[model samples]
Target: MRRRVLNGEICKRAACREHDMHWKTLERILTFTEPPGYRLSQPRGSKVDPFLPIIKEILESDKKVHRKQRHTAQRIFERLRDEHGYNCGLTIVADAVQRLRQQNKEVFLPLSHPAGEAQVDFGFADVLLNGELTKVALFVMTLPLSDAICIQGFPRECTESFQEGHVRAFEFFGGVPTRISYDNSKVAVGKIVGNREREVTKEFLRLKSHYLYEDHFCLVRRPNEKGHVERLLDFARRSFLVPIPRVESLEELNEELLRCCTKDLRRRLRGKSVPKQELLNEEQQRFLSIPEEQFEAKRLQTVHANSLSLIRFDRNSYSVPIFQSLQDTASASMRSR
Candidate 1:
């Protein structure tokens, strides 16, 4: 009886044997009422990804061409097939480029700037001064680590204008950054002989030396490297210039900009209690300082002294002294008569 019960075949008493059952038999008797929680699906067939190679080819060809000429997808595709043996349909190439561009991640590299590293760039804005539509170019500079910005307005964006703007910004900041980043403007870069080396202008080189700072040119067509100044320029145009649509003079415009950038805008967001001016102060402590005596940045040009003792610049006649050398370099002198 005990053996039968232990084996789960029958109970101790013969009368109870009807209730005993094998564990395997009981499992077989039970049925599941609920269906499976998940269903398995088969994967579909793979489509041909012909655009992969086309995309790679297009990117390679684009890297070799200059930016000014490589504006459209059709142009790039044509170049790839004619020059690089990339035999693909134009639509396919265009689609590939679109996909690659969407998938491409912006690669950011760590840029190190010493205490005095600065970057400069130009920005444009339109204003109505005295009910007259006026367009002006604003020059902007940034201390990378501190994020301190300096901005000035110029009548034009010529090399002379840039040179003067830099001098004014340095004077306002009271020091020069150790290293400055600049775009490949005609004012700074003279010519690009090969793909690698560039011949910069003489005056630009002089400015760099005078400030005791090294000048660096941003990569051709890559403006993101100098994003600091770009953002600052936007801030300045919107914050300072937009509010005051008209000003009596450039000096007045600059004065208002300084006040806004330093005083009002410097205040932290409401309830945050973090002052922008305090941040600039800390940045200044880490910034590079100018030498004992400030370098004099002069804009000298050779001009002919006319009978009226006037020198001409930008079609505007400026009066000079009669005794000055006629064909020699003279400091720009202005006389209102």
Candidate 2:
């Protein structure tokens, strides 16, 4: 059929002539001209576009929300109809949302942490806190760029321990990092619903607000997201905890850890011209200043009142206000050492 057509034949191929291929499509195939690259402009007077900005905002905010909690395109269309007086079809909203999601993923770039940025994580180790060999959770924070680190020990990995670790670590550096990266530890995160979005614990939130430092969390199981602290945890187990110094209390041992961390800065890291400590010293100036009033990191424990309106906690009797009943304050809790 091609030979006859090229030879000036009448080309009586009814099957080919009956096809729906347009002249532009045929021209591109025959002459090898490139097809038009741009999409056709949206027609004027289209109501679908007036609601696009609203849809984009909703989708952008949805990235922080749990997948299950997110509104479906149908739900969004309904919201627009009810709230924004939108009169578009469900397909329009769905298609727009799908396309926006694709564009968002394509445009996303890996973020870089500046000098006053750090990563934090926790690990468990055995130590003699008070002449008795005990296992304790250790908090590790790292300046990833300089590779300087701070490690502190705690009896447990609760919010109090977490808050203490940050305060002491910032004091150890004489300043606080502008932003700290962390894993989804319960001390820092109340709930991890979807992707990078999280519901931070109340105490951690208070601590963050108090310090005025931004906090970022790694995705679950992806330690490489906070690789510095992950590496610091292993390094602490090997180098810092070696020969286990027996201190009088956890406090003394944490102080020693800070000294050791400072000593570590004397060593140079890979691809660095100067010692790690020198780099850390220069960067510390950029860190945010410590607050005048420190955050009180405490656990809120609920205690019930007895017949005499006295609440017993830790084998100690404390008088509750006679006006407040136990039943009335069943949901109340407090922080105690």
Candidate 3:
């Protein structure tokens, strides 16, 4: 209105009254660069509205789960259908869940670790053990900064395997890392008390004390804190463990894998000029020397195989991957028990 009046298109009094604005207000509006926008259409509603409280409950519950372990939209839809009697389609539920996850997410700055700081993680791979299909646990250690990695295979992720993985990684790297980051697995952490405090197991503490290294635990459900190794886990299984090499035992498989890992260091990775072999040499030098005495990091407990072929350890039962192994191994333990 003020622009029109100034251009002599209409009288000032008529323009002011036409737009229902005082003279000063019209002047202020003319000085603005851009006008604000208002959204049109009726109030938006959701088909999932009736069950939003349920969705909120699920989202909150998911916060306690590791990101990789969280329920997906398809899973949530299945649950809603089977358990909650939800009639909505999958798309709407997915969108709502996606939005909720986005809202719940917390972002952090990119991480940088010192030369001797490292991360430890476990991944699974399928392989052939003496012409028999077997699934094995892969233990991975990585210097987060230089991308230097050490890998070893274990029959299971038991306390003993966990301990031996550390010892083997330190030996492979030729020294101990100053600080290692880990997820709060029961193998390392016994209990979680409040105030950023964790009750670490005695064996893990012994390993830490012997090596004179620090162990940092990520917040519950947030493995992104140790994400470098987590990313490498996928690459290890796909690139290193693919086609499932046939070997007599886990020991033989690990020996071959170590050779493969050593060979990998000779090649250059993407976006880097120097080969990993050179960087790995330099990184290992930064590590502390190996302890004089070998640290005992294993704990022994009597366990029994249940009718379902699951082994019960310290009141927790773990499923056996091979049925024959259950019969063969369980007989030995049962006779001893």
Candidate 3: tens digits of C-alpha lDDT, residues 1-337: 5468778999877878887888866765677656644545588898887777888898889878898987888988898889989987999999988888888777789987878889999988888898888888899998776687788898888788898999988988788998899998999999999645899988888778889998899989888999999997887778788777889988888898788778777878888889887777788878999978987766866676777779977567799766787679989999999
Model 2 CA deviation exceeding 4 Å by range: 1-112, 306-337
For every candidate in turn, the CA RMSD to the true structure comes to 12.0, 14.5, 11.1
| lDDT (tens digit, per residue) of candidate 2 on 210-307 | 98988888889877778768878899789988887788888888888888888888898778899987888889889999989967768676888888
| Cα lDDT listed for each candidate | 0.69, 0.80, 0.84
When summed lDDT is taken over every stretch of 10 residues in candidate 3, the lowest stretch is: 32-41
What digit string (tens of lDDT, one per residue) describes model 1 on residues 1-337? 3345556765445424465756544333333334334445666432215335655665667668997765377876776777667774788667756777777657888667666678999888876656677787888887766566777777778777787777777766666666788888988889977554679888777777666677778888888888878877887788777654787676777777667656543656445456655655665665456666554545556789788888897678998766555434344432321
State each candidate's clash count: 1, 1, 0
Worst 10-residue stretch by lDDT in candidate 1? 328-337
Model 1, position 175, has a per-residue lDDT of 69
Q: What is the lDDT of candidate 2?
A: 0.80
What's model 3's TM-score? 0.63
lDDT of 1 at 172: 61
